[model samples]
Target: MALRKVLQQLENYKSEKPNRVFTMYLNTDLADQDQQGGEWKIHLKNGLNNFEHYLQKDGDSDEKRNFWAVKEKVENYMHEHQKDLKKSVVIFATGEGDIWFSERLQMPVQTAFHWEDQPVLDQLKSLNKQFPKTGIVLTQKEQIKLIDAELGAVNDTTLYELDLNTEDWKQHQGPHHADSNLGSGGVKSSKKDELAERFEENRSRWYKSIAPKIDQYAKNNNWDAIYLVGSSVEVDELERNMNKQVDDKINKNLLDHEEMKIIEEVM
Candidate 1:
């Protein structure tokens, strides 16, 4: 798309939602064609293909062209299932989804990248400051290992940011099995939805992105709700995890509610 067109789209997006957000990530992956820069294309392709099939509403043959209709579809889905879909930004990261972020067509997003070899703590702290509204998303141990140092002179007791696995699973059996008999292909949502529009409109990107760490957190903590602040791709995952038909032994190591709630506090 032309720069002007992209800018126009972004302006529309901003006018429609100045504070609300949908997130994406720029991550690194080892087994990718462009091994460097996290191969964001992979994530973009995932969403595109998934959305293509997802937009098939009522036997429509060429619904993908209706890119403008995507927002309404997604919003309607949330509206209908407002109870389950927490009215928060949709988020996604690498390994599950590719990065297809057009700054001209969207807003600035929180970033998560493991630099080649730098003090992740300082980098993350700087990023935290840059994206103050979104907060920061990092692994449990990573958050603790690095972030704790940022509290230089600051009281350690005030540190309530890390979402670490701070519970004892000794009482439970073992690792829990996740019920993700998730579809690999040919999955569709109502075409009348924004999800449908996204799938239909985006044919050159990936959308299979979801933060497994977040899912694990939810499963490990037995949470009814959780927050993901990365990309709109996360919402698709939230639906997948939340709408599962059956339950599996995802986390056999069941921690006490009180202990698990501590994890939830930061997540």
Candidate 2:
């Protein structure tokens, strides 16, 4: 299921009887010493276990058993979706049988938990509100990048011969060049035009190939908006050629000179 739907379900959850809800945010970046991914499940289990221990001491036996049941449901979920755990995860579980919600996020998030009223949704609301609410597309002759600005997630695809930046098209000098032969100018001029034509063809093909993918990605992920990053000419060409639906989502274009600077500008 999509992340938005899962979050919505949690936001909409309701029950006639009193419901116990626990929300957890896990930081899954193993590189961070304090936020150890390896121990995430362990820590979560410990939290639930500790709470269950207190329930055992004071609450009725049925309530304590129900908490244990909730813990089991959470454990089973983590076990089933081990591979989906990434930079961050938000989980919500209720005391009733097997009701839960979870989503993986690309951005780093603080580890936290809250026991709140029915339909505990503040955490998800805060998470959804964070950041640029933008998707970024970076294009060069050789590659295309689709980035989720809020989540810091990226998807990359190679452009075959589109890496024109590394190629030497200048050697073919355009018709305007002073040095040329009589026969349609020098063989060099013909070569230059041929190279230019090839570049244009490749650029056209690249746009055709990538535009649909970008539209589909945005539609599936439900990005709030999208930005293009590249030269004005390239960005303009893409904007012109892309589908109307895709074009409508373009927030703006950013100069693509430096990667880090572009990220800062978008953020």
Candidate 3:
């Protein structure tokens, strides 16, 4: 995932330079689950406040003591940058009165934090696969749909659809081919073959043409992973013609299905 890549790179820098700071990781959903029932913001605020209070007191726990030293800066950072918090989880690394790392996640984590590496990293690693964002591309000969997938819901407005006039030869069986197969007309057979070839060429070109656009769209939307849903030929053509970076992110291939079902299955 893009977030993991960025975080890992930052972690490497931190390792070499060695900054003394505390990391605040908040899993809003998980925090809310601990509460009887309340808004995400309230749960998040309460969790952080409790931890901050605990850290400020003199304690035998080494982790708590470490957290105490940077409590002021960490609290200020979280308060100032609370708007960055989104669904799932958010990690904010703070020191020097500002956030060093802040990111919203598509996957949830436990609501907790530490002075250094947070437990969230371990959960992400355990998944063994990183998907900062997953997009579903449903394609056919004449139509295509790009859908963004989230934890529990699919954004219907994000569904991008493209329609084309390209026709399917299999569905358009003309008298030309029928008469030719009867051992009657050679010219009709030639025309039939030419038409069939042209149809295939046009269809293949259509798929190829859309590949780059799809790649661009994914990049613009920050989709780190994508699923292809369509006929094998169309999917293969798109994959073959896609930009290398985008092509590498393809995680699944599925036959086109109903929109809701696709979302449910993928999520």
Candidate 4:
């Protein structure tokens, strides 16, 4: 079914209770070539001056607002578990940037510009020691795109929700649409071979970024299994390695989407 919007969810949170609220963020932007090196600065808004209301498509990234959205979701989730958040920690993430947005409705405005330095493949060796309880998980495009279907599934009215999500829908309008660098020609298609290569590259980085979080989450929650979502190929590959520990819903949506809507056709 269609989950209500954030405002509606917030209303429910006010009436809920919790034992504890724990929030954490997973990193994803390390794919950029020649990334930085060092610790990160959290709560900086240096790159948000450009957009008023922009969508994440055709190159120009308004992920600053995306970060703000993450904050909104956290507030809503915290409201659901208000009894526990008095001591909860909300985490936001970026690959080279260990920056996380946590100030609730008003994220800390940035006063300086800094680069992210975290390695994409870096993993925290200690699972239980790293994270205890968790809340909002701020994430990268790559990470969210690969989320397990069950987590973002629609048993009934959710189909309507997905339709609404893509109201001014376009084909392939997932994270790739969000990341593509568009020039004057508008959205351009990469050669299929190139697309394949990019998928592999992303899958590699995603695993690197999520491995520790997965292991840590499992150890903390006593969860013997994990669900994964991704492109049919990428998540499929991920399943090969974590067949027992992870459950994948990779690209199942796209495959079921037999009525193709290539951008050229939609336009």
lDDT of 1 by residue, 162-230 (tens): 111322111112222222112212234443264345444531222112233334434443332233222
Across 131-157, the per-residue lDDT of candidate 2 in tens digits comes to 424566665543455555454433322
Better by TM-score, candidate 3 or 2: 2
| Candidate that scores best on TM-score | 2
Which residue pairs collide in model 2, if any? 141-162, 142-162, 181-186
Expressed as tens digits, the lDDT of each residue in 230-262 for candidate 4 is 356655554554424553243433322211121
- At residue 149, give the lDDT of candidate 2: 47
lDDT of each: 0.28, 0.58, 0.51, 0.30
Kindly provide the TM-score of model 3 when superposed on the true structure, using C-alpha atoms. Answer: 0.51
Question: Which stretches of candidate 3 lie above 4 Å from their native place?
Answer: 13-19, 30-36, 39-87, 117-120, 124-135, 143-201, 212-225, 231-233, 236-265
- Cα RMSD for candidate 4? 22.7
For TM-score, candidate 1 versus 2, the one ahead is 2
Could you report the Cα RMSD, in angstroms, for every candidate shown? 25.5, 10.0, 11.4, 22.7
In candidate 4, which residue ranges exceed 4 Å CA deviation?
1-187, 190-195, 201-209, 218-225, 240-244, 247-251, 254-267
lDDT-better candidate, 1 vs 3: 3
Over 4 Å off in model 1, which ranges? 1-65, 85-87, 91-255, 258-260, 264-267
Clashes of 4: 9
